[model samples]
Target: MVTTPLAGPTDRPAPGRRRPVPRRRPSARARRRSAPLTLLTGLVLVYTLLPLVWLVINATKTQDGLFRSRGLGLDRDFALFDNIARTFTYSDGAYTRWLLNTLLYVVVGAGGATLLAALAGYGLAKFDFPGRRAVFAVVLGAVAVPGTALAVPTFLMFSRLGLTNTPWAIIVPSLVSPFGLYLMWTFARDAVPAEMLESARVDGAGELRTFFSVALPLLAPGTVTVLLFNVVATWNNYFLPLIMLKDPDWYPLTLGLDAWNKQAATAGGEAVFNLVITGSLLTIIPLIAVFLLLQRYWQSGLAAGSVKE
Candidate 1:
């Protein structure tokens, strides 16, 4: 007999399949507790961004407007473009020279530092050698020492070798980043696999080839992290350059800007605070661009082995 089945409750879910769980709304007490945390987070955001806001606002103002205009508000005269032009053309293009110098330092110095740190760190992690623990201890000690403490000694050493007032003064010291080495060592220990290296060696690949082909790719995230740290440290380095360089032509942006800032204070100096402000703004743009460009690496996966059940 072809009998039609009766309809069941429309609201009931089918057997063996559960109904979707309903979400709970936060209680009033929970919301009330979260309110203070939300407020505090907002306050912290504002506090952190305040200085950057001030810099942006002031960078747009002309010298006269800088002194005369309201701090937080815009000036009637929009001279940001004019200021940028002047900033480049000022003092027979000293700013341009300083900019080039900074780029050179970062490219050669920071770049070298990152590369050495990676190779050394990877080696320290993967290689079995005598005195490896001692090397680790030394690196940790070096990391603990503040760079400022080394400035005087570095100056004295460079002075003896007649390397002061040269690019080497900046580049040489930047090449030895203990913190970068340590960071890479820690990262490599987990990010790269010993089994992979063994496989590569069994496949008749040379050490260098194995590193470049297998290990280096795995080390990219850690490498980028160390690179950024070195770049920032080398770029913003004030004390080392201050002590090492006396030539304005050799000066990095940090020292160059400081020189501009001191104009008003100097006995026979002109007040070019506007240029200082504008140049300061220019100095940080590359750093911001770098951070934005490389931020994607921070989220990507580390190295992994064969999938296991």
Candidate 2:
């Protein structure tokens, strides 16, 4: 084999000789742009996590520790387990009742809403009915209407029907989820192929069978998305429950926590403060559990949108 020396830019000693190229480093400007974004993201994460940190720390402390200790420091006397025990036993086990009520509301409301949304979405996407376009237009309009705006009218309507203070007031209203319907429509239209449905029909499957067997299986991602959205919304709900239900027995965790918070304000500073902190921590457990349990579905469901042909 013949040996060859690399040539410089100007020193071309032989035919077809090439100069060695140096690796280029990233510019200062590119480094600066990337560094700021990372720093900004770090700051944002700290800001978001700080409150959760405080809640965890405070909930572990006794009443004295809560008032006397450094905000982020652990209590010398940890009372977290004690507080949880007391919280469950408070007001004739009212917290447990509230938790059950919340579960009931979310299960019935979110579940029904998701089902209705999926059905409506499928109809709007695939079926050709006379008023289909107008129905979708109305749903779009309803999506823009904030729930806060409808609370008064909804309250009045429920009051006239003698439905106030009942679970139905909250559950019935939650069933109409315009956003879920919209999301399902978009998901069904894109995710479930028309050819699949046509083939099912040609195989002598009825509309109901096609939807349940073919379309619904394909709509798992959309259904999970809608379920999570409705669950979160219904879980954090305050105002509707506030106006509709006067009895504390009927209260969900949100309203129950608010009541505890108000009582905490007027009662001697220490006792009530401990109650509020402990209660707040307890209240969030179910929310976290639900999220963690359903998170796998949420992750998989979200990936559906990113698939390529």
Candidate 3:
């Protein structure tokens, strides 16, 4: 039997043909780099959420439990429903009226404000005319002027015009949001394309028609963001409503809740304490529901805004 000679060492595979080594795991320094940010986020979340937790716990307690028990502990009685019932029926169901008023104002005022702001922003961003930069600069300066600074002057002007103590006083002023305009401007600048507008024009579409047909859908994210901002601002507004409305019949929830809180400080009004707490908790439900419902739009809007030239 003839045996073939085995390949010699010279014919063997080169030793350098080893597999590539895996990458090293992240070192302790990388983890350390992320720790401070994590801690800061946790601190901020706690700071923002502590009051909500307190409200949730205390809202479930009865009038007696509110004063007698530890703030963090559950009460012997779950009086939330009872408190809500009294709150709705108290003083001929005034709290319900206040809630309705708030809803109306938010819908009309915030809704209109969003539409107008979107129109203004789209125009400012997409169209060019004389004094555009000056107009934008003025709007920026107006945003810098605090709402409080304008309150007194607005009150005086409304008083002179005999428009004070009316819904118009609150609704009209809310319609002009310089910040909303700026936000919409920034969003539209990045979201809407010039070529699309030109293409629509080339197809013989009028400006308004093009805006409604081609631009509005693209502007969905910006519009929703502006709408949510205006709604929250209008819903939680206190100072302006306080200055504008004197009659309890017209009071919004924020103002009405404050009044009830003050009343609870008195002797016979102590029972109102539970009502106030229950009402406060109930008021937040709509806001939470609205956020949950619109969060998808809000996220899309943010994504659109993140696109930069």
Candidate 4:
């Protein structure tokens, strides 16, 4: 108690001592460093958005207005609805057929691809089997090989099997996504715990039952990611369908739109230009909607897998 009483005012900060200054706003050097990054980000935004902006603006114009008006802005006469109507009704409603075909591809091809990727990835992550590493190496190599490179060989193989020009051609090629496999493999490795798998096994749950009931739930975000990627890929596929499909009836939206674009470029085919622009606009809307709707799952999956316990 006596020692405590002996403690002096000097033990406290001197009355004249300057309190620490609020961290001076980030140093000028840091601000200078950030300036280039800010500029680069702005440039990237403009670069990415410019095409979309042009597409939207052109989509609103009449066929005459499309060529007559400035390339980057609205025309005096807006005919967005008229263009959309013509897009759907043109050529015996072929656009509708293309749209339906695209949907079919997305649902069957992408959906199947996602399921297979999830199963394969989870299996690769959680199980041990002969040739597992070889399978993984082949997948990695496949990822490195551009789809364009395989297009010729795949077309030849399908041609021999007589699968070309059918929905099976597109669906078969889309069924295997090496990137998706790798993505799900990494995600499953982190998201599903060995302890949980062991517990499920100990409880007499079969592997398939445990996977579907327990592991699949935890893999939702990863599944969504794979599904969305495959959906977009299948929906927008051009070169594959362009080569495989000889019949216009079998054409997906991407190929059909290119056909329309080609037609528009020819003499006396100018009227179809507006339809092409409008159809292109319509094509991207579903994709945009999909991203907006599923962004939450995508973000959550990415965040969840970013850290490991």
Candidate 5:
């Protein structure tokens, strides 16, 4: 008994059981190291949300409330519905016309741009031909050039061709997306392997048939990315439409909204600031919807070739 106390049943560990391991806590030093990064991320999040918050808060107020309330503060009137009604009914339902015009541009201009980009990009990537390097260099140079720099020249060219002030003025130019073409070219290079195209060809599939049947599915992600980019660019296009179109009926929402903003400067023009804010909010909703709908595809597209043997 003096040598060792008898082991009690309670003191014995359960048979075949192991001790539970405690979760390792981060060291104080590790937390300190992450603090700056966390703080920076929070600040960036706040900065991004601030303007949107301001837009939402201000969009709810009436014309008089806009001038009366603080930038981010809401008014009690809740004129959002009234503002929307007035915005559409203003000037022979101009806002509705602008909305339709924007949809048309997005559908035709962006859609055409994506199609052309896909065809050209797929061709450039898969085909072997002369002057390919030259074409690549030209595309790169075009991408480097700012669209605004070309707006005046494009206007002049379209004017001479009698294409200005028409839908073609906007649509034709939107179809030639240098960045989109380049994006597709690169994406097609990696996404659709030459082996698959070769296999398709061996199966007696024609080039167009092979593209539509074999390669197009693989190119979905890239196509969607290019489509989104072109959609945003064409939908928000202002300077081009401004110089290209003079008719109010043809105006896209961007130009139309700007007109509403500047209307007060025109003689006998009453200010519709509340409507502008509400319309601005409405204008962005579709873009947000598009982004939300396509974001997963874009992400998958990005991760397409990330892992390889």
Candidate 6:
């Protein structure tokens, strides 16, 4: 009569049931190990951002202020707008010409490289063609060879073909991206399902149709990644264009900026330093814009590519 009521279902575990165990916090040793890594990462970030911060501060200064003020500090005169205007207007708007040329090279060269990488990577992943392994081997080998090492040889080859001093000299060399092809191949292998390809084929779809309609949607992130890499590479390319192009009209932004820097260093050319700084800032803005705009696609592609059917 005095016995307690039976325990409610929610109050305690049923017979033979065990209570859930709480997760243990990481030990002190783990926290100690992570501290150094955190400090190292902070240092690396500072090292990387220091130059960019300096550039921004200097871009806001006058030509004389660049020398008079601390390299990393702002000056009294904020000539950012004036510097930008002078940068674009100098030498009959030659900086504008170089900017346009860079756009052209990036659009045509990087775009072509991405397209080719996507197509080739898709083929390597899905098809069983002759010499596929050998092709991949060659790509791996090419990836190990630094681009700078190949620059002189490439220049000679292009020169022999009479393609030097032209846009083709830059565009043609940039169109081949071994790393892009390898990335696409890896992404395609994992992201695409054999069943999906079979389904498309059963529905009377041709290979190209199946790829474009079915596979391409899934390959979006990989494509965007390759596109961005090639675009940045082609956009910032310096030595290759320096060797290839003689005409100022054909110079890309990197070469143009170098020219401005050289002029600023010359005896009577000190006035162009601010223009050089501003032009450098302007050159980087488009790349930042591109990354921000395409980041969504890039993230989604990478995430999707990681999952399997």
- Steric clashes per prediction: 0, 0, 0, 0, 0, 0
Q: Estimate, for each residue in 34-142, the C-alpha lDDT of model 2 and write its tens digit.
A: 8878999999999998988999999888878887899999879999898888888977899889999999999999999999999989989998889888998999999
Q: If ranked by TM-score, best first, what sequence of candidates would result?
A: 1, 6, 5, 4, 3, 2
Estimate, for each residue in 223-286, the C-alpha lDDT of model 5 and write its tens digit.
Answer: 9999999999988899899999999989999999999999999999989988898999999899
lDDT of 2 at 286: 75
Candidate that would win on TM-score:
1
| TM-score (C-alpha, index-matched) for candidate 6 | 0.90
- lDDT, candidate 1, 1-309, per-residue tens: 899877779967888999789999999998899889999999999999887898889988889999888888898888888999999999999999999999999999999999999999999999989999999999999999999999999999999999999999999999999999999999889888888899999999999999899988889999999999999998898989999999999999999999999988989998998889899989999999999999888744556544233
| Of candidates 4 and 2, the better by lDDT | 4
lDDT for model 3, on a 0 to 1 scale? 0.88
Model 6: per-residue lDDT, tens digit, 1-309?
698888787988878989899999999998899999999999999999998898899999998898899898879999999888888898999999999999999999999999999999999999998999999999999989999999999999999999999999999999999999999999999788878899889999999999998888889989999999998999999999999999999999999999988985678875578888889999999999999999988645333443355
Q: Which candidate, 4 or 6, has the higher TM-score?
A: 6
Question: Candidate 1: where are CA atoms >4 Å away?
Answer: 1-26, 305-309
Each model's Cα RMSD: 3.8, 6.0, 5.9, 4.9, 5.4, 3.2
Q: What would the per-residue lDDT of candidate 3 be over residues 1-309, giving only the tens digit for each residue? A: 999999898777778786568999999999799999999999999999988998888988888899889988888999877887888998899999999999988998999999998889999999999999999999999989999999999999999999988888888998988999999898889778887788889999998998888777788888888888999999999999999999898899999999998985677865577788789989998998888898887645433443346
Which consecutive 10 residues in model 2 have the weakest lDDT in total?
298-307
Q: Which pairs, if any, clash in model 2?
A: none
lDDT of 5 at 306: 36
**Each prediction's whole-model lDDT (CA):** 0.92, 0.87, 0.88, 0.90, 0.90, 0.91
Q: Name the runs in model 4 displaced over 4 angstroms.
A: 1-25, 265-270, 299-309
Off by over 4 Å in 3: 1-24, 265-271, 299-309
TM-score of 3: 0.86
Error of 3 at 28 (Å): 3.3
